[model samples]
Target: MTSLMALVVGVLYAAAIYMMLRRSIVKLVIGLVLLSNAANLLIFTAAGLRRDAPPLVPDDAQVPAGLVADPLAQALILTAIVIGFGVLAFAVVLIRRAYEVVEADDMHQMRDTDT
Candidate 1:
């Protein structure tokens, strides 16, 4: 499972990089979103995975009887997801406003105005 997740993260990163290099503003924003997802997956894989185990302790027990999933990774991923969404939203809005003013979504065309 870890290996599979690692592969997925690698693929996501590759796709993100490919998209990021494009000249389109929409592709850049998509790449940013994919980058965040890849980061989250990497964090999750690094934290490890467990099966049939819950991160909980029973009553009258000092600690969990068996292996319990780590909660820190879950919490971190949750926080990251929320932050990523906000960033993506802002980026989209900024791109929209820029498109309105510049009348172009292509970075090359937008840069032509500098002359």
Candidate 2:
């Protein structure tokens, strides 16, 4: 499982980097999303893939140690995902506004002014 996760992370990183190099706003957005997923996967991988149950302790019962997944990683990943989604949304909006203001649809042209 760990190896599979590593492989997925590698592929995701590669795809994200390649897309980011392209001169299309849409592609850049996709790349950013993929990169975020890759980062989240990385965090999960680092948290140890133990088959731990939820950290909920039943009343009048004591669960043994080492039986709960690392909550910190889960929280971190969730926060990163939300932040990445917000960034992606903002980037898309910015791209659309740029296209409308400049009457341009290509990235290369956007890099230059209409002067």
Instruction: Give the winner by lDDT.
Output: 1
Model 2 error, position 82 (Å): 1.2
Expressed as tens digits, the lDDT of each residue in 35-81 for candidate 1 is 99999999999998778488788898989888889989999999999
Estimate every model's Cα lDDT from 0 to 1: 0.92, 0.87
- Residues 1-115, candidate 2, lDDT per residue (tens digit)? 9999999999999999999999887788888889999999999998888787878777767874557888889999999999998998998898889878877756787755554
What TM-score, computed on C-alpha atoms, does each candidate reach?
0.92, 0.87
lDDT of 1 at 62: 87
Candidate 2 lDDT at 114 equals 50
True-structure lDDT of candidate 1: 0.92
Q: Poorest 10 consecutive residues of model 2 by lDDT? A: 106-115
RMSD of each: 1.7, 2.4
